[model samples]
Each structure stands twice: as C-alpha cells, then as structure tokens.
Target: MKKISIQGIKGSFHEDAARKYFGEDVEIVECRTFRKVCELLDRDEVDGAVMAIENSIAGSLLANYALLQDFHLHVVGEIYLHIQMNLMVYPGVKFEDIQEIHSHPIALRQCSEYIDQHFGEIELQEKSDTAGAAQELAREKYKDVAAIGNQRSAEIYGLEVLERGVETNKKNYTRFFVLSKHNNPIAGTNKASISFQCGHYYGALAKVLTIFGDNKINLTKIQSIPIVGKPNEYSFHVDLEYDTEDNYERAIHLVLKNVSSLAIMGEYKKGDIELNKP
Candidate 1:
C-alpha cells in the first residue's frame, strides 16, 4: 500500500482529500501542519503529500503556495472536495445550552453568520484544526462547548452533530493538490505553472502578460506573493493552460526573455469537477 502524507490528523480535510484521491486502502501519514506535509515529501517519508491549495469561499491558500516553491515538489494531481461544516457537541448536549464554541479560525469565520444569528453570546475559541477541536471537546466531555468541524470528525470523536452545514454558503468546497517527488509523465503536456519576479520597471507586468495575449495562450490564475527576505518585493505565480506545441514554447520563451526571474514550477494534468454528488 502506498503511504500518503497529509497535513493535520486523521479527521482533517487534508486526510479526506488524501482518501478521496488515493483511496482508503492507502496508508496515511499525518503531519501537524502544511510545512510538515512538504517536509515529509522532501524526506521521502511518504510517497506523496496532499496540501490544500484553495477554498471556494476563503480564496487561495498562500502558505501552501510558498511550500510548493520551497519544497520543489511537483503537482502530480488535484482533488476538489465539497466541504460540509457541522457544529458538534457531546451526546445529550443541547445547542441552546452551549455557551462556548471552538474550531479552526477559518471555519469560525466561514460560519460567522450562523453564530451571529443563533449564538451571538457564545465564546469562540480558535484551535489548530476543526477536527482537533472536536477531538479535544470529546476527550474533555465538555457539554457546554461545541466544535465546528466536519461530520466525519463528529463520528471519529464520538460527538453528536448539533447542526450540519453551518457554513454561510452551501457551495463551500476546497481544492487540494497532490504533490510528489516524481512528476506524472501522463499529466497535461499543455499545462504549466510558473513563478517569476519582474524587474522594478514601469509596465513590466503588462509586458509579460501581453506576451500570453499575443500568443493566444490562456492564463488561468495569477497571484502575487511576497518574496521572503526582500521587503515589498513580490513574485507572481501563474497557471497557464495551452497546447505544448511549438506555439506554446514560443510564447513561454517570449515571456522569459522579458521577465527578471522565471521558473516553471510544474506542468501536470488538470482535472476540474464539481464534487459531492450523491
């Protein structure tokens, strides 16, 4: 069985993504944080790592992107998981009786509306992970404290689901990337992910983007992240999907000639889907 490394414990969304992509039969190695997930991959402790890349509601995971650059791991696959945030409590505990809630900061923010409307006075505590919060509450048998996590977490921690789908948006989903030391040979030859730093010159970004327009290559996502150790200096990460023919190569070459520093992070298969059906 292939061993997969994921950030957070068994009940985390990262683990769910791993199981969804690699199947339950695969062995799982849990890491405490996103950086450790990449470290496990770098140290060859596991075959690959699953890292959350973006959320439909919360926007891009900037920290994971930094890990991608620091680790030099290739993006071998992608998975989109529909998130179902739930409020969990100990058995026999009533929602009206709860006075405190705990969960990951992101989960709390996502369900701010529900909390404000129904439990405005509830004291919110931020934990490392949502599932971890549930596990903590379960261990302590806290009847007055609830946890905002997934239903799976409630089951794993032997907690009751006080409320399901507590997120403000019904279409909540998170995009995770499967990273491996080896790149998938069968991945999309047409797709490319690149990072570049532009010289501090007027119209530098415009010139770089115009090359893609002129060559008719589509730019899917563009994000700017700060370059560590350099105050106010940022690098642009871009995802480009285009045919890997001579035309695409020519376009890339044109952009490289003008950019200060350009590095192809990885080019792998692109799988887009709306998850959680049935």
Candidate 2:
C-alpha cells in the first residue's frame, strides 16, 4: 500500500483528500505539523503528502506557501474538499452543558459566526489539529467540552455529533496539493503552477503577464510573496491553464526570457469543485 503523510490523523480533512486522490487503502502517516509532512516526503519516508494550499473561506495558508518554496517539492495533483465543520461532544453531553470549544484555529475561524451566536462568552481553545482535538475530547471523556470537527472524526473517535454544518459558510472549500519530492509529469495536464521573480524596472511584471495572454494562456490565480531577506523585493506565483500544451510551452519559454528567475512547480490536471452534503 502507498503511504502518504498528512498534517493530521485519519479523520482529518487532509486524510480525506489523500484518500480521495490515492484511494481508501493508502497508508496514512500522521504528522503534528505541515512542515513535518513536507519533511517526511523530502526524506523519502513516504510516497507523497496531502497539504492544504488555500481555502475559499479562510484564504491562503501563507506559511504553507513558504514551505512549498523552501522544500522544492513538486505538485503531482490537487484536490478540493468541501469543509463541513461539525459540533461534537461526548455522548449524553447536552448543548447547555458545553462551556468550552476546541479545534484548529483555521477551523475555528471558519465557524466563527456560528460559534459566537450560540456559545457567546465561551472559551475557544486552538488545537494543532481538529481530529486531534476530537480524539483528545473522547479519550478524556470531557463532559463539559465540545469539539468542532467532521462527521468522520465523530465516528472514528466515538463522539456524538451535536450539530452538523456549523461552518459560517455553507460553500466552504479547501484546495490541497498532492506533493511529491520529484517531478512526475502526467498526461492531459491543462493547468500548471510556476514561480518567478521580476526585475525592478518598470512594467517588468506586466511584460511577463502579457506573454501568457498573447499565447492564449489563462491565469487562474496569482500571488505575490516577499523574498526572504530582500526588503521590498517579491516573487510571483501563478496558476496557468491552457487548452494546448504547445501554447503553454510557448508562453513558458517567453516567460523564462522575461523573468529574472523561473521555476515550474507543477503541471497537473485541474481539480473539480467538490461538495460534501450535510
């Protein structure tokens, strides 16, 4: 069985995306941090890793972007997971009995509206992972505490879900990158992610973007990341989609000539937007 590293235990959304891409039988190696997930992959301790790149509700994970650039990992594929945050508790714990809620900070932010409306003035503790919090709650059997997690976590940890779809937005979605140490190109790739640095001269960035437009390449996303130790200097990371590989190659060749430095991070098929019913 293929082993993949993830940022949380079996029931976390990372696992769900890994299984969705690698199948249910794939072995999961849980890590407490996203850096560890990349480390395990870099060291060849696992075949790949499922790492979250961005979320529709919570915005991009900036730290994770640095990890991607630092580790020099390649994105083999991608997955979109519909986030359905739930309120879970120990069996027989009533809603009124709950005084504290615990979960990952991102998960907490996603459900901020729901939490404030129902549990005003309650304590909110940030845990490393959502499933870990739920697991701890079940292991300790905390009667006065509730956890915000997913339904799969409730089932795996033997906790009762007190409420479903507690996320402030019903359409919450997270985008994950299936990363590998080496570049393994796949056929029928309509999307590509690349990073490049532009000169300080006028219109240097605009010139590079025009190359893609002239070549019929579509830019889906673009982000500016500050260069480490270089005050006021930045690098651009962009996702491009092209109908033909030839057009993509042409645009890339032209972009390479224009940018100060360029790296092709990944070329993979785009993922569909997925939703999990509550």
Candidate 3:
C-alpha cells in the first residue's frame, strides 16, 4: 500500500481528492497544514501529496504556488473535484435553532447565498479548516451550531446535512495537483503547466504569449505572483493543452528563446469533468 500525505483529515476535499486519485485502499497520512504536506513530501515521508491548486469560485490558491516554488517536488498528476458545499448540523436541530455557523473562510464565501437567506440573524465564524469546524461541532456536541462543509465531513463527524450543494455557484470545482519527489517522465495527451520570468520590457509578456498563439496551443490559465526578495519582480504561471509529440518541444523552445527564464513545471494527464444533471 502506497502512503500518501494530504492536508487535513479524512473528510476534507484534499483527502477526497487524494482518495479519488490513488484509490480507496491506499494508506493516507494526514497533515494539519498545507505547508506540512510539502514538508512531508520533501522529507520522503510519503510517496506523494495532494495539494489544491485552484477553486472555480475563489480562484487560484496562491499559497500552493508559493510552496511549489519552495519545495523540490514535482507535479505528477492532476485531479479536478466537483465541490459540493453542504450545510450540516446536529440531528434534531432545526435551521431556525441555529445561532451561528462556522467553516473555513473560503467555504463561507462560496455559500454566501445560503448564509444570507437563512442565517440572517446568525454569526459566521471562520475556522482553520471546514472539516475541522465540523469535527469541533461534533466534539462539543453543539446542536445549535451548523457547519458549511462537505458531505464527507458530515459523515465523519456524525452530523446531519441540512442542505446539499449550497454553494452560490453550481460550477464550483477545485483543481488539485499530485506532487512527488521525482518528476513524471512519461508524456500524456493533455495540458501542461509551466513557469517563467520575462525580461522587464514593454511587450515582453505579449511576445511570450504569442509563442502559444503561433503554435495553435490553447492557453487555459495564467497567473502572476510576486517573487520574494525581488521588488517589482514577478513570475508567470501558464497552463496549455497541446499535443506533446507535435508541439511540446517546439513550444517550449520558442518560449525559452524569447523569455529570460523558463521552467517546465510539469505535464500530466488532463482532468475530466462530469456534466451536471439537471
């Protein structure tokens, strides 16, 4: 059984993603924080770690990107999990009985509609993790308090789900990356992630992007984050889906030839999305 490290406990989305990718029978090592996930992987304490890279509702998880730059791990695979935020509470507790709800800040923001409509008189408390909030509620046996988290959390903490898929947006999906100590040498027929730094000049970014355009590669996402200790210096994060044998080498060289520095973060299998049933 391969041991995998993930941030948070059994019910978290990270853990869910890890199970989805590695299967249910694999051994799981839970870490309390995201940084710890990277630390364990760097120390070879586990085979790999799963880290959430972005959420459709909240956008990119910048902290994970920072950890990618700091750690020597490489992305081996990608997983896209459809996030269904559920509002759960203790059994026999009515919605009107709730005085306050607690969850991670991101979860609270994602389910703003439910909070605004039902919990008008209730307070919203931010916790370290959504599953952690659910666990705390279970431990304290707070019947009047509800938690906005996943269904798995409800199952793990013995809470009853008051509502399912309560997120304001139905298209809520979070992208997670599987990180390992070794790079994935095998090629796949899917998207690629790369990081690069462009020279400080006008149209430098435009020129770098043109390489993709010229190669007929569809750029899916792009993000810019400031580099530490370098004022006004930033790095570009890009995602594009292209035929590996057809355009991988040429596209990389073209970008590297034009850009000051280029780093191929990883190329892995593309994520598949299931169509929502009405």
Candidate 4:
C-alpha cells in the first residue's frame, strides 16, 4: 500500500482529498502540520502528500505555496474537496451541556457565522488540527467540550455529531495539491501549474498573460509569492488549462521569452468542481 501523508488526521479534509485523488486503498500517513507532509514527501518517508493549497472562502494558503517551492516538491495532481464542518461530541451528550468548542483556526473561521449565531457563548479554542481536537476530546472524555470536525472523525472516535454542514458557505471547497518527488503526468492532462520569476521591467507579467490568452490557454488562477532574501521580487504561480497540448506548449514557449525562470509545477487532469448538498 502507498503511504501518502496529509496535514491532518484520517478524518480531516486532507485525508479525504488524499483518498479521493489517490484512492481509498492508499495508506494514510497523518501529519500534524502541512509542512511536515512536504518534509515527509521530500525525505521519502511517504510516497506523496495531500497539501491544502487554498480554500474558496478563506483564500490561498501562502505559507503552503512557499513550502512546496522550498521543499522542491512537484504537484503530481490536484484534488477539490467539499468542506463540511460539523459539531460533534461524546455520545449521549446534550448540546446544551457543551460550553467549549475547539478546532483548527481555519475550521473556526469557516464556521464563524454559525458559531456566532448558535454557539454565541461557547468558548472557542484553536487546536493544531480539527480531527485532533475530536480525538483529544474522546481520549480525555470531555463531555463538556465539543469539536468542529468531519463525520468521519465522529465515526472513528465514537462520538456523536451534534450539527452538520456548519460552515458559513455551502459552496465552500478546498483545493489540495498532490505533491510528489516526481512530476508524473497522466493521460488527458489538460491543466498545468507553472511558476515563473519576472523581471522588474514594465509589462513583464502582462506580456505573459497576453501569451496565455493568445494561445487559447485559460489562466484559472495565479498567485504571487515573495522570493526569499530578495526584496521587492516575487514569483508568480499560475494554473493554466488548455484544450490541446500544442496550445500549452506554445504558451510556455512564449512565456519563457519574457520571464527569467519558468518552472512547470505539474501537468495533470483538472479536478471536478464539488459543492455540498443542501
């Protein structure tokens, strides 16, 4: 079985995306932090890792992007997971008895609206991971404490789900990058993630954006990360989708002429857009 590391415990969204992108059969190596996932993959402790790159509501995780480049890991694939944050507790524990709730900071932010409205007086605590919070609650047998996690956490930890789909946005989804030591491209790979460094010259980035448009390549997303130890210099990471390999190649050819460095992060099939059901 393949051991793929993830930023959170088995019941976390990272695990879900890992299983979705790789398969349910793959061995899940849980890591407490996203950086640990990248480190493990780089050191060959695991075959790959599912790293959350961005969320629809909270936006991009800039630190994770830096970790990818710093660790020199490649994006072998991508996964989109529909986020559903639920409040869970010990079995038979009444919701009224819950006075404190804890979860990852992102999870808390995602469900801020629900927390304020329903759990107004609840003491919110931030933990290292969402599922870890539930696992801790179960292990410590804290009946007064609750957790915001996935249903899998409740099932695995033998807890009861008090509330479901508590996230502020029903359309909330997180984009995860399947990182590996190698750039393994698959058939029907219509999407590519590339990072480039542009000169301070005028229109440097604009010129490349034009190249993408002229070549019929869709620039789905772009992020600018600061280059370490280099002031005022930034590296641009972009995701491009093309109808044909020829167009992708042509765009890269033109883009290379305008940038100091161009690295093709990966060429993989685009993930399907998933939304939580009402």
Which has the better lDDT: candidate 3, or candidate 4? 4
Residue-level lDDT tens digits of model 3 in 61-104: 88798788789678878898888889899888898889999999
Writing each residue's lDDT as its tens digit, candidate 2 over 1-278 gives 88899998979988888877888888999998899999999999999999999998667888987898899999888899998989999999999999999999988988999999998878999998999999999999999999999888999999999899999889988999999999867998999989899987889889999999999999998999888898767798899999999999989988889888998889999988757665
Runs off by more than 4 Å, candidate 4: 228-232, 276-278
Tens-digit lDDT string for candidate 4 (1-278): 99999877878777778877787789999887778888899889998888989988888988888898888888878888898889999888898898999899989988899999987867899998888999999999897988998888888899898889998878888899888887665787899989999998788889999999999999999988888899867799899999999999888998899999988878988888756464
The sequence of per-residue lDDT tens digits that candidate 1 reaches over residues 1-278 is 89898888878888788888888888889887788888888998899888898888889988788888888888877788998889899999997879999999999999999999999867999999988999999999997999999877888889999788888987888988888887656533666778899887788988998999888778988988777898756699888878655666898889888887888777666656576862
Question: Which ten contiguous residues of candidate 4 have the minimum total lDDT?
Answer: 269-278
By TM-score rank, best first, the candidates go: 2, 4, 3, 1
Tally clashing residue pairs in candidate 2: 0
Give per-model TM-scores. 0.89, 0.95, 0.93, 0.94
TM-score, cand. 2 vs. native:
0.95
Clashing pairs in 2: none
Clash count for candidate 1 is: 0
